[model samples]
Target chain A: MTAQIASSRVQRSSDMLAAPSLDSILALTAPGMECVNAVILTHMQSDIPLIPALAGHLISGGGKRMRPMLTVAGAELVGYAGEHQYKLAAAVEFIHTATLLHDDVVDGSDLRRGKAAANIIYGNPATVLVGDFLFSRAFQLMVGAQNLRVLDILATASAVIAEGEVDQLTAQRKVETTEAHYLDIIAAKTAALFAAACRVAAVVADRPAQEEQALDDYGRYLGVAFQLVDDAIDYDSEAAEMGKGKGDDFRDGKMTLPVILAYAAGDEEERQFWRDAIAGFLNSDEDLERAVTIIARHGTVAATRQRAEEYAQKAIAALSIFPPSPIRVAMEEAALFAVARRY
Target chain B: MTAQIASSRVQRSSDMLAAPSLDSILALTAPGMECVNAVILTHMQSDIPLIPALAGHLISGGGKRMRPMLTVAGAELVGYAGEHQYKLAAAVEFIHTATLLHDDVVDGSDLRRGKAAANIIYGNPATVLVGDFLFSRAFQLMVGAQNLRVLDILATASAVIAEGEVDQLTAQRKVETTEAHYLDIIAAKTAALFAAACRVAAVVADRPAQEEQALDDYGRYLGVAFQLVDDAIDYDSEAAEMGKGKGDDFRDGKMTLPVILAYAAGDEEERQFWRDAIAGFLNSDEDLERAVTIIARHGTVAATRQRAEEYAQKAIAALSIFPPSPIRVAMEEAALFAVARRY
Candidate 1:
């Protein structure tokens, strides 16, 4: 009976993925998102004008706000009716924005979300300082939530995310990086926050331990799927669709899942080609095209998509523990949408 | 009678400054220091070897650990005999170290504490991520301390410190920066944490509001005095004595109190010279020497020192509300020592 239910859900998810859109999922959390936005704008206020100015530049920029939406959606899934979820959702957004500001400086990129990166306009020092302010403000919001358990989860997630970023930094330009290593990196850098965002929803609702763990699993798998698709999009999508330039990961020599899979499956000559490419020997538009062709030849994009689909299935399975509801359906659809998006 | 006591304390502090050393203060906190060090080492552990390796490099890099010492000393002065102070002291050090890691990257600094900065060896992204890890670890420690008040104080201080750093960044190389602006920058960037570190001791000890406020004032004034002396030492001390380098503030075109005062006191031609020097027009050793000469000719170093002394006196006076004891005496001596140190 359990297997039958799981198989049916898997079939349904595949159908959902065929025409995936976040519209339904986003609509379910639209009210909570408005409250989250208000909280974000309110807490970002500072006596130092540069803080608000720099923060506003990015916050108002065209981010999908997917992480905060996940938080709100997760809260509703747990049947949480309290106001604390709004603050927690805003806190999640603040953490994401803070990391983005610092990430741009670390990457030394001049663009973010189709606009001039904050560091480019404000300078690295101001950008880094403002990032710190936002991070601290996120903590203040968590404290205001008046839940130590939530603080513990978010704080630990923050540390894990930082560790994952450092791990990725270590793995950069190294063609020897494995799929397992890539999974670990993504789990830490991306999935950890998603898991925490979902788990906090259960925390606020004072749900059973099983429910918390289930939502956490759902988010973790969904996040991994989302990042996998994002990495694949770097090689497969158009510049306009990606919201930043295409081939950014390739230009930066970042060793994402697609690159890792392609490198491992390639012949010796092809491996050397990847090595040189990542080592910056390859250049120009022709080289990028050739790199993409090589990736396609190995079927790594399809392999990467296959891996994302597996995680998406896991995300769907995790929700089976919860009873069926509109919120649950939207969340399950959101997981499918994560992997199905082209960009 | 109160006036007489204050005058006598002032006289004693002046005498103490003549032969100033932190030996007595450090000795008083020596046992607490050991526990704090242990906590720091334990919390810094990670499966990622790089996290500990980079953190250990800086943590063992021979900082005075003055901030942690202040925390331990504050707790001891409040007559708090508890284990929580050790964790709090370590948290204070972690916060300070985290800021330094990010600050080095922001400043593009090559050396810290007479060694190559972490960013030079580990890369900026690793340093930044590790700094984030340490900051989150600090919050985790605070949460373990189980005091909401302590969390509030430290979290708020973190935000203020970030704001101060941004204000300083905005003021950098601007000859028009005023003494008031300089004070505000230092107060937020440095003294806010100092005050929080001290105030948290009272919170943990469950001391009265008066004691909490008194210790906070003591830390705040001492921190201002310490930074003022540090800025003065940048122009007055030898490279060997200063650890990192002398004239770092000058080279960075930082608008310290001495620079602000000298610029304000200079004639039109001298003001243009100051402006040109700060704007990077002056680069040679002789130019630096001439800059020092002009500052001396205007007596700005002396003026800066006089201001530091005033704050140090205020720090000592703030301790009068606490009962006279060995701990109180050491704290008072520590404040005097802050301004008296040549480096």
Candidate 2:
């Protein structure tokens, strides 16, 4: 391997340390999961060279492989020693990555996971088509799971995610966006997949109805918490550490949790700053800094974190319906840790 | 309705005459097909306002609705009177329209079917997202058809189309693009959906083995024929009548069949004109006109049309397995007309 590949592997190893170590959770994974993993690796092929290049560039960017891990973890938690869960896990990851591709294009974002986005390097058209390729490939992988319920849950989730994205585009810069509206958008855009990820695992495991519902609830709450923290980090993280300019939410005119909280707090000067900066009445680094300062002053980040904590608690509570297992415990811990992690 | 809407409606009526009148097609439609149509209309909804706006624009834009018609016709051709065909038909149209939406975005096209393209009016992001929304919804609708085979076929076709599109993007502005490469791209990007559409209809209809293969062949050949004509018309059509501006293939650096033929036949001066105009070396209207003149001089358009006719004949020949019916005859005629009418 090249020096760069070696360094990347080392970096990935370090990033893995940031999460609650999954050693105990991974122990329950059977040999069948490996088979599913192999299937996933084989099926990601694209006949077009540029597509595989773009896909490789994005996949090798070294984020925590949390979503796919969750799939395997969820299945293990349900005592599923079957091969299908691994495929489902990989399918969920592909779908997640596909959404990111489109999301970057839609937001015109240049950075993701501290690397230049695929759209930035390959242009929007290639990004969009490769995203579509991944979506189709993901669906193909899911079909291999051969479970109707999993298919239904996933297909619906895919539809809602697309709808949520379109909703987010229209809702941008709209200060009147209510908590209900925010929930709807986040549910569609983020939580749907997380919920489906867990539900599909339970489904392939052939879990009973009530247990399946509980897993879904846990996944949904975890996803909402994850996204809430993510939105908060967009404003709160330092520019260098975040690998992008700070206050991206404001720069993009997105009404994320912190901005929404600050708006609801109704500090007159803060409201004025937002009205000017995010509403396009002001355009300067000063306006952006002022807006971030106002959000900080109102303790919006703290409130967002508190909201995330509530979701994490709800996720842990939902797990009570499942039988005791190391994987389950790790999932509960992961939900808490997801909110606790920093850039 | 205003004069434009009235005229558009009249034009739609006349265009229907160019094939079979819509009324005749509807009158002969089996009861099973009516079910498919109803399901298709119900599933196209999105919570986002922009999606609906884009949909209205696309639905109103007067393409022949030939793809969906083929899907419905394919189902009926194989003695299928089932409810799933309509969902499949709608699914095919959704996939086709979704591609068109993305194509306009990638091609930087301003007009499609004689009106402002969706991207031009709604902005590229909205158009792209809405296109994605339609695609996901298409799969969801196909899933509702409850045939795993149909689901798999459509999913694979969607991937092929996306891959082919990426190939086109990478190959654009390259004068060395071969006829084989051009055919491969078009077959995947355009004809794959048509093949899948017909194949799914057969699968849902539970047709005999021979009939299924025959219909699949018919759909594939017809799709290739349709696309060839579309490509040929771009080299020399009357822009006012086609609603698509002429020389679009060259202007966009799209290496379609006519350009490939022109390259094979042109002298040094003509070849240089193509090389400069199409290879991004020059991009002026004068250059565009010169390129068009050279291609016409080489009978590239005629050669392309001949290839299209051959595909149409192949498509018609594939339907020999079907018993005689007016609907079957109309479908055969439609295949021939797909090439003959446009070019």
Query: Largest TM-score belongs to which candidate?
Result: 1
Please report, in order, the local distance difference test score of every candidate based on alpha carbons. Answer: 0.86, 0.78
lDDT of 1 by residue, B53-148 (tens): 999989999999988888898998888978899899899899999999999988888889989999999888888889889999999999988887
Question: For this target, which candidate reaches the highest lDDT against the unseen true structure?
Answer: 1
Query: How far is A115's C-alpha from truth in model 1 (Å)?
Result: 1.9
Sorted into a CAPRI-style docking class, model 1 comes out as: medium
Task: Find the 10 residues in a row with the least total lDDT in model 2 chain A.
Answer: A5-14
Collision pairs in model 1 = none
Give residue A255's lDDT in candidate 2 (0 to 100).
Answer: 79
- lDDT for position B233 in model 2: 83
TM-score of each: 0.94, 0.91
- What lDDT is reached at residue A225 by model 2? 94
Over B1-343, each residue of candidate 2 has an lDDT whose tens digit, in order, gives 2456434444444454356334434444545455655765577666677777787688657666677777787876777766788888888888888889888888889888878888889888888888877888787887788888888888899999999999999999998899999999999998998888888878998878888788889989989988998888887644234766566776788899998989988888878877887778777777777777787788888898899889988998998878766566667667767776653
Model 1 chain B weakest 10-residue run by lDDT: B1-10
